[model samples]
Target: MTEETAPQDGPDGPDGPDGPDGRAARPDREGGAQAARPAGPAGDPGDAGARRGGRWRRPGPQQVPQPHPAAKGMWRGDAGGPFAQMTVMPGRMSVRLRLTLLYGLLFFMAGALLLFVMSVLMANILGNVKVIGFGISDAEAAELQRQFVEQTMRQLVGRSLLALGGVGVITLVLGWFVADRALSPLQRVTTTARRLSESTLHERIALEGPDDEIKELADTFDAMLERLGQAFDTQRRFVANASHELRTPLAINRTLLEVALGDPEASDDLRAVGRTLLATNARHERLIEGLLLLARSERELTARTPVDLAEVAATVLEHSARREHDNDVAVHPELTPGTALGDPVLLEHLVSNLVENAIKHNAEDGGELWIRTGMLEGYATVQVENTGPVVPAYEVERLFEPFRRLNADRVESAKGAGLGLSIVRSVVLAHRGAVYAVPRPGGGLIVTVRLPPGQPAA
Candidate 1:
């Protein structure tokens, strides 16, 4: 017997030695093998290939495909698809209103269903009643009975519908009241949370009610506040104690350095070393002071009085005049009446830091500085603009962080410790105000501060 060879199936299974579509593979002009498909009814080779392979094919220039009726509202950019449209609500409907409406709708539906059932039963019962008439034809009596049943049903349905409408209105009103009462506890929680901050962490919800979900949430919030208050208190005490302990040693060192430098017979090298040590000591003292001020500003102000921002800015400018002249920076002030409620010392510090920062970071020669203080939109406003090297917009916000400066390598900086802007921000926040900075157009920065307006001090 002759050796039998089993035929191997093509990749698509049990097909002849051809392409997946059962057509012989032919080499194209590009020397690539492709299936040779017969033309379809439209006599287009591409169409035939698409049909044979069961795949989507782009329409030719002469052919345009019509959209199906079902796809009329689908994939539209302006109107959006059905699923996207379904997610859009008609307007701003609060949860409480939605619940109330839902309750009223359910009641209305139940009432309508009950009316329908009663009407049907009444009609069946009236239809079964035998018509009893004296001295009248049975057919006439039956017609009269039919008319009476129709009239009675009409009156009953009308009255029932009217009653349902009145009851639905009352139901909506009651539902609204109930929803408001139900959500009142949540509203309290929200209000307390909004009013509480780092300074007011001692405030608690202390909501008194049955141990339900809302009460549980309020209790949890109160517990969080208690823990936060403890943490903040501990932090404040540590900072105060550390600063006090450090001040004594620094003060002693400064006194010793001054005495050593004042010695008449001291060698030149010894004198130079003493002066350097004194400068270093002064810098350390300034750093400590900055830290203490920062801690104080981050806490709630215990005392507040009307402080004129324009007067504060004028004082700062007077003190900064020598520094500005030495740096070859020009100061332009536009001070008008702008009073705010805050601690005078902290507000002065805020203005001083801003003015010093502006002068220190100014251009080498003839840098211009502008300081404006006035009432703006019912808020006391102070704005400072200066000329200096270009500051990137992305780095503006980081300047408010403690120990952060425009230059990454700040250790060797002769400028005061990198706490100027940080202190300013703290003071602004302590006063419940806002401060922001933006990069100047050509090169430099513009810092603006807005505080709650206060009455002039009498």
Candidate 2:
């Protein structure tokens, strides 16, 4: 380091760490000035101990000269040389910015065009005034008329040019505003999308107002994110459920086979083990099939015709009434007339899965189930609530995912594959609907489904 003058003020400020003035800027070790210097390849000098409060006193009239590292990069210098010995950072001109320059150029052109037009108009007026003011004899009358005709033509041309210039300016202004308005929604969607992660999938980009292009764009964007969130949720649940379900059966079969080969067992014991394995295998198959169906529903993009959601709910009740051998739930319906436009197959699946889920999770000792359907806004909604054990609030969202089951208490048999809720969610999505499973107030679980209604096409 080059030798330089140390501050004449002893470097340490008047205030100390515990002083009334507050902590000083001087290094604790040096008891003098605290200066940070750029390090060299050789090594940096020993740094003084940190000041208690990291305050640096403002240097007085005297200035301290410090060395700054010379910038070394492709853009370090311009044709004129380095700017005050500081490197010029390279910057890029984006397409939008470059296009903006054309705007400036057109602005200049419009000015030029107006000036040229005004000049010609003024010249013609001056010429006509001169012709009318100057005296004319019989011999010069024809020449005067010729001059008048030429000036008249020039005046007409100037007027036309003025009109064209005005049109161009109007066009440019309108074009700029329209283009900006068109892309505004896209900008909002982009910003929200960047902030989105697995944790914030619930946030939506719902554009309000009339069904214009920007509104439509926002709607489409929200739908895509919605689907993605669902897919991720389903995948997570499927993996967990499949692992749990498969492990149970494998463990049982291994134990039974080991017992039969290693030790003598009664005929009844062996048969019972075989039956358990068979039942587990059946559940495994159902889980796999459910997973496949959910995957297919998520992948579909085409919209389906609108049907009556209330009717679909009623059909599902029929299947639920006889699904389980011993599901003794008392089902009641509060049906209302409504229409819904969506995939019929998916709609049916949504209703069936929800009601079946409601009944299955309830106790067989006469659990109560309430199925209600009615017009909700421009669509139809069905809610199936049943009496059962209380479900925790935090786990409500996860239960809709494939292979997700809440078994923290471990009270019920954990052997069944956890794909029912996942399927319900997937089918609901295919119908462009929403599904939520909540702990029913006063009793059981509530599965709510909402679908858009279809109106007659114009």
Candidate 3:
């Protein structure tokens, strides 16, 4: 490195010239390590070798995460579909509104493109015009060049718009045909899906072509329908079992009552018989009521209204206060104000059942209680909690069934038909609401009911 030839340092670079990046311009310790710099305006290539790290800039919504090694052979275009995912919106834009919007956009674009093409053609053909008339001389043409261009442009725009009107008519008809043809499959899917039910779940859409998304959708729906059919069958069996159990006691009591009243020797035993018969009748009535509650749960229709949940809770607590078992139980109502969309009568019945059940199972001597009712965002919920032994984990779910109670002995004596929770569930279901029972965190059980608010089913 003689002084004359050794690379000189400049204000912008280092001695041996490490240009702005601070990399060596000359060979490093390794013979292969020297990076050359770009020669100014001359095409000699140099150390502008790579953009060091963080060089290339992206414009929008970064998607730089490297693909997984396991995803070999998958195309890069799997990020999103051409259209948004198919959504089952209860409502959509009206057809007239959509058509008008599309046509308006197309009409504007067609007129603009035609006008641009016509103007370019006219400018090439006619040299210029003077004061609106076509000119021959170069001197006059030079003076009126801008004026002629402006006038010609106006004429071209007008002519192109006329032509565009014709194209617009054709485009509208073609667009309508294409849209209808494309949506025909969707229409078929809609028809097929509409026919689906517990019994008709076997109905399926035929895959007429390739195994596309729509085909996949039809397959998925068929599977869902099959599952529903199985569920309905199971429900039917349960109802049948419950019905048989309910009818037996009624039949026995009816036969016994008739036999006793028929005997002549029974006259002295009439008071005793009457008392026993009354007790039997009460038990029979309760059993029938429980069965009816279970049957009602499977119904799809309900009367709905704007119901005050707090008021219902208050009413239930009052009614439950009169229960023979509730004499010792103190009804503690949180009395939170709430509104729910449901049948007021049914909602009241639901609340009464929950409160009554809590009362029925309470420990002797004025048991503690917690009752709450309140509205949330467009929904309402009611919760009833009581101080009692935490229910067994396994038996909790069964308690909602007709004639199911933790203390089956207490319930079987006809004090309760074990149908209180069942009736609550039926009424809640009829309102398109949900009812569930859970053991409280600390101790005891809490029953909750949630219902939609405002728009109720008629």
Best by lDDT: 1
RMSD (CA, Å), each prediction: 24.7, 26.3, 26.4
Q: Write the per-residue lDDT of candidate 2 for residues 201-267, one digit (tens) a residue.
A: 7899887777888788889889998998998788868867876686677567656655664554548
Better of 1 and 2 by lDDT: 1
lDDT of 1 by residue, 1-458 (tens): 11111122234321112111111111100101111222222433323333433111112223222221211222111112111122223477888999999999999999999999999999999898888989999999999999999999999999999999999999999999999999999989977775566767878889998999999999999998999899888988898798879999999999998888889999999998988888888888888898899988887676678899889999988877756344478887767667877899999999998988898788987898877676543456677878898887677777888888887636433677888898987787667565656666567777767565568889
lDDT of 1 at 316: 88
Clash pairs (backbone) in predicted model 1 = none
The local distance difference test score of model 1 is 0.68
Better of 1 and 3 by lDDT: 1
Q: Residue 173: error of model 3 in Å? A: 17
- Give model 3's TM-score versus the native structure: 0.45
Clash totals in order: 0, 4, 4
List the candidate numbers ranked by lDDT, top first: 1, 3, 2
Q: Which parts of model 1 have CA positions greater than 4 angstroms off?
A: 1-96, 123-150, 190-204, 322-327
Model 3 lowest lDDT segment of ten: 22-31
TM-score of 2: 0.45
Q: Which residue pairs of candidate 3 clash? A: 36-46, 36-47, 37-47, 328-366
